[model samples]
Each structure stands twice: as structure tokens, then as C-alpha cells.
Target: MTGWRAIIPLNLGRERKTRLAGRLSPSERERLVEAMALHVIDQLRSAGSVAEIYVLSPAEPGFPGTQWLKDTRCGLNQELAHVLGGERMLVIHADLPLLDANEVEALLREADKVGAAIAPDRATTGTNALALRDPGAFIPAFGEGSFARHRTLLPDAAIVVRPGLQIDVDKPEDLELALKSGATSIACPI
Candidate 1:
């Protein structure tokens, strides 16, 4: 049986996307967050290599075909560590609006070749997606220069470069890039 599962960590805080506050209103940011997260889940569902999809958040996202785990309101690393066990898993960020099923399949295929794999952001400083053959292989470092940090932890892990997976919406420029790349969400029309 396949032991691979896709785990998405969502920060369902009211202040989500604070970086975009200067441009978008609070309600708009919230809606965009929800829309992008749902889009990510949809893509993961369509990926044949993904055995299951799980959302780890403080509140229920109300998405079907996904198991929601009520997070402990702790930091990202701690929350992820709480759920890590003896299972092969892929940790995907919820902000990848352009993420597609084929990209996810390619990531899984790469992970199968290497014990672990990571897709770094455009700046090559942050990690957008991480796949591990064993969840407990290394402690997850997910903030600021995480790409290099994760590589330090798992030196042999493959570094994948997929355009769709790299464009995570964190700043105003990121949103613009995602929009220009044909990213569509239920909240904001393309």
C-alpha cells in the first residue's frame, strides 16, 4: 500500500496576508486565502500519486475529501512536529495559487527517486513544497532562508524547480506574479 500523504499547513488567523494589507482589505485577503487554499486542495486531489490530503489548521476548512487536524495554535515547526510520524508525507504550502496536478505528480515522482525533495521559491531562500519518505527524517525549518536550512538538515535531498510550485503568494509582487501567470481563485477573478 502507498504510504504517501499530502499535508497542507494553513494558518487560519484573522491577520493572514498582513504583507498585502496595504493593497487589499482584510475581507479580501481572507477570501483570497480561502480560495487559494481550496485551489491547492483541488490540485492535490487530482494528483494520482497523492494517496490522501490533510489540512492542519486551527479551524475547520470545510473542504471535502480532506482530513482536518485541529492544530495546537503553536508555531509552524511545532505544529508540524506534532503531526509527524512514521509515514511518507508531502508538506505543501497553501499559498501556491498556480499549483497544478501535473506539478504535484512530478514532485511525487522526484521524491520517489530521492528519499526527500524540496521545491524552493523564486528567491531560492524559502521552501514552497517538501516531500519526505520518512516524516521524522529531519526537523522542519520553514521560515526565512528555509531552503538552505532544509538542505543543511537533509543534504542529499533533491532540489526541484517547478514554476507553478515556486510562485507562492507572500508579498504584493508575488500576488502580481501569480495573477500574471494566470492564477485564478474563487475570491478574485482572473
Candidate 2:
């Protein structure tokens, strides 16, 4: 199978990661966003199975290796639906602080086997990473409780479970988990 292309949707706005506002200052949240996004991108690059990387956001985060696709303000689902390349599309969240190359490779291997794979967030309600062998066939339904939506849509999809792929920082508790996940970064260390 061909190497996968990773699609990372980064929220670069000042209010990015607003859920963490109570736990982190605005600047801290921004830094956390950048650091986590960069970490995800770094892992993707390290994965030999990933051939390319694309970042979808309003403003470029200045990550060097990724091709920044100017978001059309069309929202996540629509924007992802429009992305066209890559033998297969790997849609991964930027807040996955624990994500590493091993998870990326593992997810892709499962995708190669089943044509589709999903890594549910720690709570098992949302999707943290998705591998679509046929990108056009899936519309990228990511939001609260998205795991069930994708699961219902693609019943045959392989379910990939791993700490590196299952953890994502979104809430106050999630932030703590991320820090404990050996990611002592949230703007120069939490």
C-alpha cells in the first residue's frame, strides 16, 4: 500500500482551545496548541508510512514540513471533504499531545488491512485520529460524540486503541492527562 498523507486541522485563533481557558492563560493555550500540533506533525514525519502532511487553518502555524492549506472558513467537515490527494487520508487532531510515530504507523497498518480505521479519544466518545483508505467516501464527521457517528457509517472500520492515539487535550482534566503523558509542554512546560 502507498504511504498515507496526514491532514491536521489546527485552530490558530486567539480563542483556540477555549475549553482550557479555565486551566491556562490565553497565551498558554496558544502555546499548547502550537506545541501539540507541532508534536503531531513531527510524529507524522517520523512515520515512514506517512508520505505527506497538510495543515488546514486560517493562519499558518509556520510549521515547516507541512503544506498549509488556507481554510475557507467552511468549517471542519466541509473543508476536509474538499481535500483531495493522498492515496489515503489520515485525519488526526492537533490536540493529541501523546501521539507518536508508532501510533501513526499502527493506525496506517490497520487501515491497509481494513480500508478504514479510527482511533477513539480516551473517553471513547470522540475520534482522535481517522484513517480513510477512501477519503472521498467519508465526510469527516468530527465533533462531540463523533466516534459513534463514524462507527455507524463505517462498521467495517478497524478500531485502533492505544494511549498514544487515544489521548487528546480538550478539557481541564485532559490537560492534566496530557502533561502526565510525558508531554511536559504547554508553552515551555506546563
Candidate 3:
């Protein structure tokens, strides 16, 4: 059995904004995103998993102890393969503020057993996390309706249903809901 490692796909852009339209200023939204990332990373490191956490983003001096994939040409699948190095991988989106270590570990364990697993977001359109023993499963299909596509590809993959894993902050309504519930982040603290 292959050991489990984590791959966090972070699209670090200067003008990144969580709120759609003009709900929040660009700077304010970026700051909130940073805070959420920090919180999530801290929680994951605290979990004490031997699995490596591969962060694919430009170097953020504020965040350390992460392996950054600076190559822009390396799409999500390539970056994931580069970081994970052919081992079983658990891929999680950076926007999931409520992603806890326990939930992550659960998905990893299930993947280990079933060879594939998926944690669908609230809309069931976007996949927040996916676990696969094979790197081929990490193809670049992360847009809407991806959850169903993944399920179609891997029918026997385990399905983990948890509110924390399902809720991802993509727009203002999502962020507001997460804030109201005091959602935690998956950011690592180095």
C-alpha cells in the first residue's frame, strides 16, 4: 500500500478575491484568504501526519516550510505529480476553509482502501478534495460538474460526506456562511 501525501492547489494571484462582484475590497478579500490559508496549514501540521504537504503557489514570505511549485506551465495535475512523486495523493483545493485534518485523514484512509475517493463540495459541482492511488486520476478537470465526472470515472471510489469538506468558499455567500459558522482553515504554520 502506498503512503498518503497531501497536495494543496493554491492559485496565488495578487488580485485574488473571494467575494464575487464588489462585495469586499480586493485587499480585504485577499487578506481574508491569507488568514484562512494560514489557519488551515496550522491545523494540518498540528495533526502530526507524516505525509508531506505540497503547496503549489508562488512563495509567500509570510508562509514558510512549504514546497512551492513556481512553474506556471505546470498545470494542476503536473504539479500534483511533481509534489507527490507517484505515491498515493490526497488533493485538496485551497479555498476550503473548513478542511480539517481528521476529515482529510478519513478521505486518505478511504482512498487507500478503495484506490479512489472524492469529497464533493456543497454544490456537488466542484470537487473540493480527491484521493487516488494513481496519478492518472488527477487529470485537469476541476471546474463545475467535476464531481459527477470523477464519480463516473471511478465508480467504486469511496464517497465521504461531511459539511466541512463539502463547503468551499468561492463567492460572497459562501464566505458569509463560512464566517457565520466560524469555519477553520487548512493553512500550514511554518
Candidate 4:
């Protein structure tokens, strides 16, 4: 209960992953989103530093165990900003299909040493995972070029670089990358 609270912000709306529409069917996209979200939840559950997992989405709690938080309908950054206060928090994107226990532990270790930690995407321009010890003082700034913005905002934050932490499925090529990396079944936590 004293450890960091993990939050995975999900967009379960009709507009989810519209960018990938040309590459995948609507149902396929939804399945991919659900699988990745479940994968993220499972990874958090396996990690020792994660005290609790919360899913912030407008949809019902489709996944078990994690507490459901009704999204504010505001964008991710604004909604997450409201929850960043009063506790140590980890905000991770749900599309990381390769995330495993070791990467989560490493990110936590880096965060513990510094006041905060950030895992940038493969392009090193976006943030895939973020951990904040004194979250009350840090605003969630997730968007285009977020990695540099976050680093500039939190100078003491450790930049954690790992394969699992960096790969996130955003474009059509990213899906190929994940599949090539053997992400055959992301929801199978076992």
C-alpha cells in the first residue's frame, strides 16, 4: 500500500486507434487494444513495486482486479494531471506489448534513485512509461515530443532505456515490429 500506484490510461472509445484503420479492421484494432491493455495490467501485477493498478477509461472495467476510474473525457494529460497528486504514481501507455517484469522493476529502481523516471519510445521523442515519486509537483505532459518536455520538466528524472519499455504500437509498422518480436499472444499472462 505504500508503493507506487500504477495507472494505465486507455481510450476505449469508437475513435480508438483510428490511425491504424488503413492497416487493420475495426474489430482487429479493438482486439489489439484490449490485448495490449490486458498485457500491461498483467505486467504490473507481476511487478513487485506496483502496489495497485487502476484503469482510467470511460468504458466499464472489462479487466478484473484493476480498479475502474471513470475518465474525465478530457484528454489524457489533463485527466492524468488531476490524479497525479497525493501519491507516488506510474503512468504507462497500454500499447507496450513486450513489457515484462524485469523492465518494470528496472524502471521502478531508476525512479527510486531519482525523484522520477521516464522511459522514452524507440524514437526517443515520446514517453512510454513515467514514474513520479512526488507527483504532486509534476504535471502529466504526455503528447507529441513529450520525452524532451518531460526531461526538461523533471531534470532529475532518470531516463530508463529498455526494449520492452520503448516499443509501443502506434503505426502500422509498429504492429509488424511487435508481431516480429513474437507478441503472438499478449493477453496470456501465464
What lDDT does the true structure give each of the candidates?
0.86, 0.85, 0.69, 0.86
Clashing pairs in 3: 37-187, 40-185, 40-186, 40-187, 41-186, 41-187, 41-188, 42-187, 42-188
After superposition, which runs of candidate 1 have C-alpha atoms over 4 Å from their true positions?
1-3, 186-190
Off by over 4 Å in 4: 186-190
> lDDT by residue for model 2 over 10-116, one digit each (tens)?
87653887888888888787778888888899899999999989998988767989999888888898888888544688999998888879989999999888989
Model 3 per-residue lDDT tens digits across residues 84-132 = 5476777777767776778877877788778888999998887888888
Q: Where is model 2 poorest over a 10-residue stretch in terms of lDDT?
A: 181-190
Give the CA lDDT, 0 to 100, for residue 2 in model 2: 72
lDDT for residue 77 in candidate 4, whole number 0-100: 87
Candidate 1: lDDT of 115?
A: 80
C-alpha RMSD (angstroms) for model 3: 3.7
Error of 1 at 111 (Å): 1.2
lDDT, candidate 1, residue 16? Answer: 90
Error of 2 at 78 (Å): 0.7
Better of 1 and 3 by TM-score: 1
lDDT of each residue in 1-190, candidate 4, tens digit only: 3787999999766567777889887878888888888888999999999999999888876698798878979888888887778667999999999999789989988888887999999999999999987788567789999999999999889999998899899898888888889786543321
What candidate 2 gets wrong by more than 4 Å, as runs, is 84-86, 185-189
Alpha carbon lDDT at 153, candidate 1: 88
Position 141, candidate 4: lDDT: 81
Q: Tell me how far the alpha carbon of residue 189 in candidate 3 is from the true structure, in angstroms, after superposition.
A: 16
Weakest lDDT window of 10 consecutive positions for candidate 4: 181-190
